[model samples]
Target chain A: MAAGSGRAVVGRQGAPLWLRKLGSMFLNVYAMAGFLYLLLPVFVIVLFSFNEPGITRDGVFRPAVRGVRNYRWGRFSIDAWKDPFKLPDLTNAFQTSLKIAALTTVIAVAIGTLMAIALVKYDFRGKGPISTFLILPLTMPEVVMGLSLLVLFVSWGIPRGFLTILIAHVMFSVSYVATTVKARLRGFEWRLEEAAADLGASPQRTFFKVTLPLITPGIFAAALLTFALSLDDFVITYLNRGPQVTTFPVQIWLTKKSGVPVQINVFATLVLIVSVSIALLGLYVQRRRERPVAD
Target chain B: MSNARSTKRWAPWALLGPGVVWLVVFFAFPLVRLLTTALDDSETTRRLGGGGIKNFTTIPKNYGEVLVRTFTYSLIATLLCIAIGYPMAYFIAMRGGRFKNALLALVVLPFFTTYLIRTIAWRVIVDQEGPLVGFLRWTGMIGDSEGLLGRPISVVFALVYNFLPFMVLPIYVSLEKIDKRLLEAGRDLFASAPRTFRKVTMRLSLPGVFAGSLLTFIPASGDFVNADLLGTDSTLMIGNIIEKNFLKEQFRPGISALSFVLMLLILGGVLLYAKLLGTEDLI
Candidate 1:
């Protein structure tokens, strides 16, 4: 037993083994706890989606009294899931968010792709300054960005509405898309394009057939990220949106004062599911692509 | 030859045109306008033109407490994030072995959910009768009647929770880059485990530390949602003030002035941090 204990106490590097063992044990516990902290809120949000809207007293949904609270388990019900769109304004806000995200993704991806290509493929005056200037918006606080844009819109006589919100979303998203695409273009081989040109391809054909295909994955990734950013945005959208326009986040902010509806959780769960699916799909595609090269 | 040369010269411009123009018109122009708006007199209602610099004087009287509180809360939150995040990052980078990518993905997965929804969950978790409050009360950390929500501690806790991943990922990136041989070298030289960590590991991870702090600090400082949901009237940050001034109160000039000053302070902090860290590629 003594010999066995000694053998177990020795580490690979022959250092004092108790310290390593203790340190690693502590670290593993800390990491697991941290991950739990990160995931606990998400789990709670999903779990509460199944909760009955509230205790119904004689055909009336009675909310938990303000100061008096209950930690008891809520009865399970699928009513929220069954009628996810029961709240008309919530649905409208969700639709508005989707519209803004889609439009922002399209416009930002187009402009950002061009800018990325310019920065990577060509050298010109103001290239350095322009590259640095693009990062400025990212470093600025979201509140500052939103406030300044509001001031600009008011001064320019542009009515603050869907158009203004769209512009703000695109403005913030373009830098992100550009940065993503530029990082992808870095270390990319120019020889492929050169070879295509040498093989009797026109400039447009070379770009379409060679360069575009090579960068499609990066472009797709950037678009997905930009869409997520736009969808999740609150600060900028809230500040700039007109009374006529309301996105999902703004709706949540407004509704929080008057007891958040259960359908909101249902909507949030759906979004979480969609985003996770996209991420998993991206991972699957990446693995499939990498497998070919590895083999 | 001249035609080819000219085409090459103009190609970059053509490609860069739309995006650069958009940024200039929307981003750059707004910043300039904000400065002018802040400095312009508030009494001149329709003056889209210009006004005197007296509008700047109102900032100290109106927003001094909020400005101070904002930085203090942000600073405390940043410190807490570093404390919690660094250990997790170190563990993953050093001991994750085959599970490294999976662990990193787990860190990022939580953020894909809606930010406000996650914050709202905190409200539920820290409710008056919630398990967390019960645990704290049982542990003698708070009075029996006291709850966790609607307090400064809750606001800061939410901030740390929301931005912890930002701190972790950067630190993990830097920690992962530290060669395994360096740690082995330290051990070979008879340095103890703690010494090895302090000198070799900690020294090298400063860049990540700097990056993580900046990422956490900047966003937390600007955030209003956590404070709004988890805090009471007296616990408002600069973001809450700016939001109130911009939206409800419709104090445009005051909002602009407060925003300009906040941006300048953040800018100064970032520059000073960059200088201290000796890094220029932060963006």
Candidate 2:
């Protein structure tokens, strides 16, 4: 107990720092290793994109040679980069994924923003239940949601194609959009609208000029998130996708049998680049917004 | 005045209408449909009302192994995520003074790539002749007969790898919110560092832990991709079984039954967890 008090005095004076330093150092190493683990697959994907086309042996293009796996960086080749669209249906699938994602984002953001507004700005009957119900889709597994939707479509005699995929995407994406927008709305003050109203702005005019501008960042973030979710969705898309429609993820899944083309890496790399750029841009904007307040 | 008051009362409903209706039709309706279909016997008819309670009862009798494996794998994966994620989250929260946002971004950046592609990259990394395998072989850890692929370890590793960010983010959020002054107070009280961490830090971070574990465990349980890509036939999860029943075997009723069971189990686990953590409002 005496020793402990002595150490506490040293700690209070902020001089007994070795333990804290040692702890932080250890934490830094662990954090670095964790980050490396997260990035290892990404590095492998990008690195192997430059690998030479697998050689065909006995009418089969083997990805790796004997005693060496296909993961190795063999001879560097620019063939994949030169013709990333080598696969026949790759572009079609990419386009389909983009269309679905865009449509889903727009529709989800429209409905979700309104729902978020309602949940935040108004007190109403069934509000608690509605909030809980909205979160249900997020908690449920993708496979269950997909299978159930498939059943619904099949039973309703609705042809399972782009339409069904769109419906399913919107279904899942709304919850996300609403959640994101609601988070943003939580920090918002409704009196801004009231102030605008008192300043002679019409209800619609206040919303468009004042409220919408304030919440635009959240809406934008939500839309981007929804797009990413829709684009990368596999399990649900796989189950709901009709025989005719194939999204990029479904195409990639199918390619597992035929051997994943190097072009898929190229596509994935592009997606990574686009998403990172958007995120960095968002960070920059947020920093800029916070700077004035800090000052 | 009365007319305006009524409009104000209905306004929230009007705002919530489209999104709620869409969810009801696409989300809630499908769940109800799934329950009905699961209870029905598809062998007799494609429509509902033939199987009764047999579908639910047959789950434990028939696919019990798959159900157990799914939870087991998910549980193991969630624990692994916590082990790997907690330290990293702690480091960023406590020590990442100026670069906290940048560090957090680094954690999330890898998720920009498609999840499937990332999992596939694991296949390459753990390939028979891959570097990881080579290293293991060099250390004489794995025999020539023992490979990383087609093993339970690889599947769980893939799951931990993929869903780690989900675990880290929530924990980071909770940990970062913890006031540093509380730690200082504990220190000022002459509490040892480990004791302070346990009593103050860990206790305060329970909500994040609960959220992170749920996020990691739920999806990991439902995921078939890791098991399909990394594991052998022996490691097939309930997800694989459901997928097979739906897509391959074309057994709709059976798939529905399995899916219903899986959903119930997850929902029950989540409710129980939420109750224990007293974090119903956190979600």
Candidate 3:
């Protein structure tokens, strides 16, 4: 205690001398600056969205001091939010995105879960090679993957549409989900399953009743992550989506081909908020469930 | 075989069936077909092979220029991510309190947002009428409309901004996993703080750095989203060329060969990175 307090005294006495503690603090400050850099453009976009002047003349967005009139309130109105179908483009895009995301998430999670189970529960030939093959898609560039899928579809005379989009999403997203579930399975004990079987449960019942509940968190994480990946996928969707099938990202990309509107800023903020909120909520729920183990 | 052996034999296959089917159909099939076409399409080979290695060569041609530009842009963006992200990762991992998870969550949240929307948003912020331009002009930094977004720097800046979290999160996880006692031990030996960091912290965190850079570089190198919205036609990356081939040009054979070559290059780099980081288990 004396030594601790004495060092505290020494530290206090040397407060004016940062030479003793220069590098660490500098690194900390440098890191914070980097954080600011990372966040600056995003925040600026959100900020500038409110700067709309309701009209553009001579290629200049006349600055309006963020009055309610300056907000594209009626154009991108709350009515559209409440009844999305009123705006056919947004509604169609939203519905398409939801359908694709939901299907992709379900397929990815189910397939990934089964693979994780087999990987953990059995020893098989070519296991190492198989695992590598499974993980390859996750790291592949989205554009390359998108182009390759497009080529195969064209070659095989498969028409590009909703089915193609969903298939492509599931193809890429399954790898991520599989890796997540497999990591969860790695440290899981087999005794619980044995105990269930010992108590007269069949293998399927044992898995459903005991093992499934334990691994559900990982499965849930996988689903949510896949949903985001599916919704956000542009490269693949851009390549394979039929002319009539425009998801939100495709719409935004097309709009970018024209001049950008400030409303895009508003929409982007909402997207960022929604995605961040869902991820955080999912993480919060998972962490709450995990607290007991951590303790 | 007996019934017991049959049941046991099919169980693992039953479990693995869906995943294997999914990969074989969507991944392996597509790659096989694309590569076969790239090497076999009569017209493509006739054109490309006549030029020998020169056709596949990554120079002189506009495609070659685009590839080089892609490498240069991604390399710059990746370096910037490391320079800007490592410190941020260190800050959140070492000194942040209960808010660390919340902050990290913020960093990753952008990943969930649509890439198209994010890139488009940057366009609005940097447009001629955008506030960024106004602020710069007001500060007398530029007198003309051709300011931030009109230049390569802004394109690189936007790429760094979008991809920075990829660089930070992996490093943050690695840093968080490091033993605190090791750092304390370094300090106990009366080494200066910088010395301790260089010898202990940086050495241990190298894996995370490699992982983060791999995550950033691979995506950024192939990314066309930022280049499209933030860059001019001259600044397009390899992804833009791929996008053009698929969409506008419809040069399937050239695009396939380009894609195949690009994949090999990226795979080689990732393998090297994994080796450097001493992690052979990378997917």
Best-performing candidate as measured by lDDT:
2
TM-score against native, each model: 0.92, 0.93, 0.87
Residues B185-207 of candidate 3 have per-residue lDDT tens digits of 76567654567789888988887
lDDT for predicted candidate 3 compared with the true structure: 0.75
- Local accuracy of candidate 2 as per-residue lDDT tens digits, B1-283: 9998999999999999999999999999999999887777556633433266776777787789989989999999999999999998998897788989888988887789998889989998888867899899889999966679999999999999999999999999999899978977888786777888899999899899998998899899899999998898899998898777786434677779889989999989988888887888776
Off by over 4 Å in 2: A1-23, A55-73, A293-295, B42-50, B248-250, B278-283
What shift in Å separates residue B61 of candidate 1 from its native position after superposition? 2.6
Arrange candidates by lDDT, highest first: which order? 2, 1, 3
Positional deviation of residue A96's Cα in model 3 after best superposition, in angstroms: 0.2
Interface C-alpha root-mean-square deviation of candidate 3: 3.7
Q: Who wins the DockQ comparison?
A: 2
User: What are the RMSDs of all candidates, in order?
Assistant: 3.9, 3.9, 4.5
Interface RMSD of each: 2.9, 2.7, 3.7
Q: Candidate 3 has which clashing residue pairs, if any?
A: A31-B87
Q: What DockQ was computed for model 3?
A: 0.54
Please give, for residues A1-295, the per-residue lDDT of candidate 3 as tens digits: 2332344345533333455457557877786677666566566556645543455457755544443222221222332233324445655776788889999999989998988888887777767887888878867888888888888888888989999998999899888988899988898987988889889999889878999998988898788888988888888899999998988778767755443445555556677788777776877787886787753
* lDDT of the candidates, in the order given: 0.86, 0.87, 0.75
